[model samples]
Target: MRKGDTILFETPPAIAEFAAVGGKRESEGPLAARFDLLFEENTLGQETWEQSESQLQRHCLDLALQKANLAAAQLDLILAGDLENQCTASAYTLREVDVPFAGLYGACSTMAEALGLAACLAAAGFVGHAAAMTSSHFCAAERQFRTPLVYGGKRAPTAQWTATAAGCCILAGKGQGPFVKSVTFGRVRDYEIKDINNMGAAMAPAAAETILRHCADTKRTPGDFDAVFTGDLGIVGTRLLKEILEKEGLKLDNHQDCGLLLYDIDTQDVQAGGSGAGCSASVLCAHVLPALRAGKLKKVLFLSTGALMSQITFLQGESIPGVAHLVELASEKEGQA
Candidate 1:
């Protein structure tokens, strides 16, 4: 994270490739429609983590730049990453695009970090435009970081299915148009939980810690913002986060704090909570952006939480490393000084 970064951009614009809830092609399997939404196909045979995740991010970014009507050369940086270890997917996808880049590692918090970086750069007058992008593939990430395809290990009720998707947003300086207003980074916390199956429990404390810090740093009350959203903590983690926050003397109202679990899917069973880089990306791209445009929400605080652990660490009896990053999104136009 940078030392000094403030909001100077007007407002940021985002885009995604998935029908979170309903679409004309709901009958198609999730994989097929996901590809169709991104204007790609499974030409590489079975879905490889590298191919699909990279494709979705690349296409989504192209669309984002197009929407913003800016050429690739205009961007000073392309901050991108994903949940995969070492961020292989986001790195590979960024290679194909044209921009100076910084690879980030925060699992689900990748996108938030990227946005924060861009906002900081723009505010510091380091660049006029920068883009933040991230993508996740259920198959690729699971096969590599957690379990193999053949394992098929039984998932506990606390498991959250990784969502397969990608999201991109264009953050421009005052010259580039409306963009991010402000970004806050969370301190990484060490939680001794090592079991991967119970990720929600492991990550909850981190969320709680960050939520309190964000409220304090911004000097804002819970009721001041329309909603406070967490990236993926699902059911179990969300409850734990709220509980921990209140215990710390910070009260988060029910409607005020919303968790991006299961996206817009209810019938779909998400065990502990939704977990993935795509979980927060998809929800923000689909619901939050539209809600902001519709004037349904005024200020939104998006806090993306991640469990910073690897299968190797867990196997070696290492404790899980968890982190969360916060980005403040507001629908109202900037107030002139």
Candidate 2:
């Protein structure tokens, strides 16, 4: 094996299920209650995304490393990124953990990008072991990028819910673990969907294009893989994905292969879907891990999709740009390791 070659995703407690455990009754306010449902435990009642992101990464990384039985120094490389512009959240939080690292930002698709780079390095014998981590916070992201929740403003139907959480994965050189067979990168598309009210509309094209590329580059059909998932395109983005993919002669099954809409909290009432980098990371950490561990899922594709356009960019008359990253996660084949 090479430096950053083999990748393994550590299974962790599901965010929704974990949030639901010893579940508390729904609280007041749709947005507030929505956050409470997803991150109440990790949040400790923080009202802002900045606060939540800071706290969650610190705790989540510890749990992830523990589950993997990995020490900070054991990893030769730590590649991290997130939805936050400067990525200081992961920077500051990761400081508590001792490791050499680099900060990255691909919006929602950050984890995939980091993994993709890690895999290339490993495959090329650049490094032996690497860890990729990314996270998001609803309060911090919304206030800085969108409208502050304190104003009690009404969000449009297209608005996606920002999730508060974190996710981390360890990639080994070539030692008995899930192998990252390949990674497919997508082109950026600016769709002019600047409403900020409809991020799903903005990010759907990116997801569709990337998924199409993955199938094309790998010479595999949608049916070839057990699942083809997207980051946080939400309900509307998923709808757009179905339509767009069909145009390109590709189709995705939401029930089986997609990861667009995972937040089902009753209070959020977000008609479109979930948003933010954490939306995908949290769901992958929760649902995908357990399914793989149970031996119920064999091969799965994870596409972390993101809308690159920021609130200020939209206000500045720039269109909402999008990008999607594809990662293949599969357990070892019979006796291959």
Candidate 3:
């Protein structure tokens, strides 16, 4: 059923299993222990950084399936994406799996977008089992979107580190707990910020807009959720988002950004924090889902924000447009009632 801008799932899809994989730097972060697998090297024994990113997605999917006690043949569909040209990372990752695949490109918001779509399909009986995954590699993103590592470019203070990470979640029509209750797809919003280095500022307005819309659509307030998570907004974008929300009469007290939670910004030299498609993906799988399953969090909102800009667009001096997607998750106890 649809309510305002939100799609309320009549039968909430359960996150049957999930996995998180991260690179060396992420393994050094505060949430390191939460990740299922960590690679000491960015390459993961692959010939190229892009190939390594593919491996990250592949490994995450494999792990999630293993945890669910399901095979690739049992999966009805796989929705995946990445921060690569043509979404090659996800395509190559599933090439040998022999499953129906759909590629998505929501920039950094790919995870939430993929998960929301998968949940909708699952609830509608279109698929019994589906996988949603996304990945990003620091080296590959640097080579594609900015200067190559060899350039030794000086990053701005507001610049964020693109994480070398991946996450996968397998949703089933019926399962144990941690259900996806609803979803809100965000609209594109451009703030006319041209600096490619400061993605947090470029994406903050959209985050605010989406949060406000979701709240109004559901007739809920910040107090209704145990927590609100914004994907990869970093330090700068997070502060801006709060300010924007405050001005709109919404004061969020239990808010956290996956960017900030993924790393120890002060000592990590990550400038603002982490930012990438994989940043929130890995964090959601590693930390948030577990909390929901354990009943530590009764209800929560996961919002993934993205800067919808390409290298070509940035080079052409096009202003960055941002988007955010929201998914409502609840524990089994709450979902059942």
Q: Compare the candidates by TM-score and give the number of the best one.
A: 3
Model 2's lDDT to the true fold?
0.64
- Each model's lDDT: 0.65, 0.64, 0.93
Error of 2 at 272 (Å): 1.4
Tens digits of per-residue lDDT for model 2, 80-185 = 8777768888887777778888888888888678767776666666666677777776667877787776888887777776666666666666655455666676
Deviation in Å, model 3, residue 197 alpha carbon: 0.6
Top candidate (lDDT): 3
Q: Which residue pairs overlap in candidate 3's backbone?
A: none
Candidate 3 yields a Cα-based lDDT of 0.93
Candidate 3 Cα RMSD after full superposition onto the native fold (Å): 1.1
Tens-digit lDDT string for candidate 3 (184-299): 99999999999999999999999899889888988888788899999988989989999999999999899999999999998898999999999999999999999999989989
Question: In model 1, which runs have C-alpha deviations exceeding 4 angstroms?
Answer: 1-47, 175-179, 254-261, 264-266, 335-337
Q: Could you list the CA RMSD of all candidates, in the order they appear?
A: 4.4, 5.8, 1.1
- What's model 1's lDDT at 151? 93
Q: What ranking of all candidate models by lDDT puts the best one first? A: 3, 1, 2
lDDT of 1 by residue, 146-231 (tens): 78868978778877767666667766555322234566777788768777877777777887776676666556666677788788
- Candidate 3's displacement at residue 143, Å, is 0.4
Clashes of 1: 5
Q: Give the worst 10-residue stretch by lDDT in candidate 1.
A: 16-25
Instruction: Report the C-alpha displacement of residue 12, candidate 1, in angstroms.
Output: 9.6
TM-score of 1: 0.84
